[model samples]
Target: MNFKEQLTRFPILETVAKAAAELGVEAYIIGGFVRDLILSRASKDIDVVSVGNGIELAERVAARLGPDVFVSIYKNFGTAQIRQCDLEIEFVGARKESYRTDSRKPAVEDGTLSDDQNRRDFTINAMGISLNKDTFGELVDPFEGVRDLKRKIIRTPLEPEITFSDDPLRMMRAIRFASQLNFDIEPDTFDAIIKMKERIGIVSAERISDELNKIILSPTPSYGFKLLYHAGILAIMFPEMIELLGVETIDGKGHKDNFYHTLQVLDNVAQHTDDLWLRWAAILHDIAKPATKKFDKKVGWSFHNHEEVGARMVPVIFRRMKLPLNEKMRFVKKLVRLHLRPIVLSKEEITDSAMRRLLVEAGEDIEALMKLCRADITSKNPDKVKRFLHNFDLVEQKLKDLEERDKLRNFQPVITGEIIMETFGLKPAKEVGIIKEIVREAILEGIIPNEYEPAFAYMVHEGEKLGLSVQSTGTTFE
Candidate 1:
C-alpha cells in the first residue's frame, strides 16, 4: 500500500523527516502505528525507528517542535518519548537482540532496520513506512505483513518458536490481539505457543497480570480464556480457573461444567458493563465449585457454600496474580460472597427484611450487584429464565421503595458504642457491642424506623436487660 499521502497526515512526521535528514540517518514509522494506519484504526502513539542514536534524533525533533514540547528519555532502554499535545511519539534506534535461556531480557545492539523488523513479534507489526527525505512514505514489509493483515491472521515475522522463545510475553499478546480484533492465530504459531508455553515462567507476575486484565476487559473474554487454556498458559498461570473446568457424574446425574458456565456469565456481564472488577467478580463467582462439589442420593449434586469459599480465595488469588489488594480486591471479594444472596432472595418469597438486608449490605453497590445476579441466570429454558428475571424485577422494585422510604442504604445506627458506654456507665466490653448490634439489627429488621426515638427506646430497654440504667431522661442521641 502506498502511504505517501498518509505520511503527511501528521505535521510532526515532517519535522521528524527534516531532523533525520539533518542528522544524516535513516528514520521510519514502524510497528503497530503503521499496521493500525493500514487498518484505518485511530492510533496516537507513533513508534519511530532510526538507524542512529534515537535519543539524539528525539532531541533534534523536540528542538524543532519548540521548547514547549517535552522529550522523556529512558537511557537504560535506549528510547525517548515526546509528548506533543495528545500524541506520544516514541523514538528508538533500530536494533537486533540476543536472548539468554533463563531471562526474557535481551542483549541489545544497534543494527539495520531489517534486523529490527526481523525481531518483531508479528508480521503485521513488522510493517514500516519510511520518513527519510529520499524514501518518504515507502512501505517496508519484508515479512509479507500486508498479506497477513488482509487474511486477518497473526503470524510471527520469524520462526514461531524462535519468536515466542525470545520473549514469552508475546504468547499472551497473541491471544490478546486475537481477542481484541477477533482474528485468528495461524495454526503453526498457535502450536509453537503450546510447545513453548512453559517459557512464560520467565515473565514477571505484574506483566502477566497486566495482559490477563486486558484480556478480561475485552469484549468477549471467553475467547481469550479458551485460547489460554488450550495453550496451557491458563493452567500454569491461574490454576483456580482450571479447577472449575470439569464435570463429575454419579448415578446418571452430572453437574454442568462450571467453567463454561462462568464464561457465559462473564460474557453476559460484559454485554452490560465494562467494569473490570465486576467482570472479575463474575469469573470468581463460582470458582470454588470444584472444592465445594459433592454428591447426594437425594439432591444429586451440590456446591454448598461455594460463594463464601470463593470469596475467601479472592485475596489469595489476587496476591498471587499481583493484583491490587485494596478496595478493588475488596469489591471482588464482597461480590463473590454475596452473589448467591440475591439469587436466593429472587427465587423465594421476597421479604422487606431480606430486601433491607441486601440494600444495607450492598449499600451503594446494590445496582451493580443486581446486574451480576441477573447475568448469573444462564438457563437454556426460556420460561425458567423469565420467571427468575420477573422475580428479580420484584426484588429490585422493593429495594427502591424500601431504600427511599427508610433511607437504609447508608444507614448508621443512632446508638454508637461510645454512647452505649456513656449510657450504661461501662467500659468498652462485650455488653457495649451487644447493645449496638441490637440497635442496628432493630433498624434493619423493621423493628423500628431508622429514626432516633424508637431506636433509643429499644436501646434503653435492651440496656436495662443487661442491668444498666439510663443516666439522663428526655435526652436525644441524634
Candidate 2:
C-alpha cells in the first residue's frame, strides 16, 4: 500500500526528504513509526534512519525548520533529535550491532538500511518507509512485516535465538510487545526466550523494571508476567514475587495460590483504574500471605497479619526492583497495609466510629483505598461479589457521613501536647501523650464531640482520673 496519505499528515517528512536530497543521504522513516503507521496507531515519536551521517542530516533538517525549533544532538551515540510542535523526530545512521556474551551493549558501525532492519527486536518494527524523493513513502518490508502484523505475531527479523542472545532484553521486549498489542509470541520466539532466559541476568535491574512496568500497564498484564514466569526470567529477576506461587497443604488444609490470586487482583484493579501504584498495591496486597500462612483445625487456612507484613516488605521490594522509593512507594505501602481494613468493615456492620477511624488513617487516600477494596472482590460466585460491593457502598456512605460530621479525614486532636502540659501545669512528659491519646480516642469513639469545649472537658476528666489536677479548675471537670 502507498503510505502517501500518512506522510501528508506529517509535513516534516517533506523537509526530511529535502534535507536528505541536499545531503545526498538515503533516509527512511523506520522502526516503531513505520510499525505503528501500518497498524494505524497514533504515534508522536518518529524515527528516521539514513545511510550517511545522521547528525549532519538532522542539522540540515533543523536549519530548514529555522530557529524556533529545538534540536538536541547526542554525538557519542551518533543520534540527534528535533522537536517540532508536539512531535519528536529522532535521526540515526543505519547501523549493525555485535554483542559480547557478558554485556548487552552493542559494538556499533554504520551500515546499510537492511543491516539496521535486521537488528530490530521484532519483525513488525523492522519495516521502513523510504523518504528519498523518487521513492517517497514507499514501504520496504524486507521480512514481510505487514504479513506478520496481519497475523498478529511477535517474531524476530532474524533467528530468534541469535536475536535474543545478542541482547537478552529483547526477550522481555518480545513479551511486552505481545502483551501491549495482544499478539501471540511466535512459538519459535517463545522457545528462544526460554532458551536465552538466563541471559536476562546481564540486563540491569532498571532496564528490566522498565519493561516490567510496560507489562504492568498493558491491558492484560498477566499475559506478559505468565510468559516471564514460563521463560524463567521472573524467577531470576523477582524471586520474592515468584515465592507467591503454589499452594501448600497440611492435613487436608490448604491455602489458595497467592501468586494467581495476586494476578487476579491486579487484573481486577486494571479494569477499574489505570493508576500504576494502585495496581501495584493490588499486586502486593497479599504478598505476605506465604510468610504468614498457618493452618488450624477449625479454620482451614489463615494469613494472620499479612497486611502488616506486606507493608513492611514494600520498601525492600521497591528498593530491590529499582522502583521509586518516594511517595509512590509510600502510597503502595499504605494501601497494602490498609487493603484489608475496608474489607473487614464491609463484612461487619458499617459504623460511624469505624468509618471515622478509617477516614483519619486513610486521609486523602480514602478513595484509592475504596477502589482497591472494590477490586479485591474476586469471588467466583457473582452473588457474593455483589454482596461485598453492596456492603462496600454502605461503608463508603458511612465514611462520607463521618467525614462530613467530624471532619476526621487526617484529623488530629484539637488539644495539643503543649495545651495538655500547660493546662495541667506540667512539662513535656509521658502524661502529655496519655492525655492526647485520651482526647483523640474520645472524639473517635463518639464519647465527646470533636469541638474544643467538649474535648477540653473530657481531657480534664481523664487527667483527674490519673490523679492530675488542672490549674484552670475554675471551669470545672466534666
RMSD of each: 1.3, 2.2
TM-score per prediction, in order, is 0.97, 0.96
Clashing pairs in 2: none
For model 2, residues 89-191, the per-residue Cα lDDT tens digits are: 9999999899998989999998999899999999999999999988888999999899999999999999999999999999999999999999999999999
In model 2, which runs have C-alpha deviations exceeding 4 angstroms?
A: 471-478
After superposing all C-alphas onto the true structure, candidate 2 shows an RMSD in angstroms of 2.2
lDDT of 2: 0.90
**Candidate 1 residue 259 C-alpha distance from true site, Å:** 0.5
**Index of the highest-TM-score prediction:** 1
Worst 10 residues of 1 by lDDT: 469-478
Give the alpha-carbon lDDT of every model: 0.92, 0.90
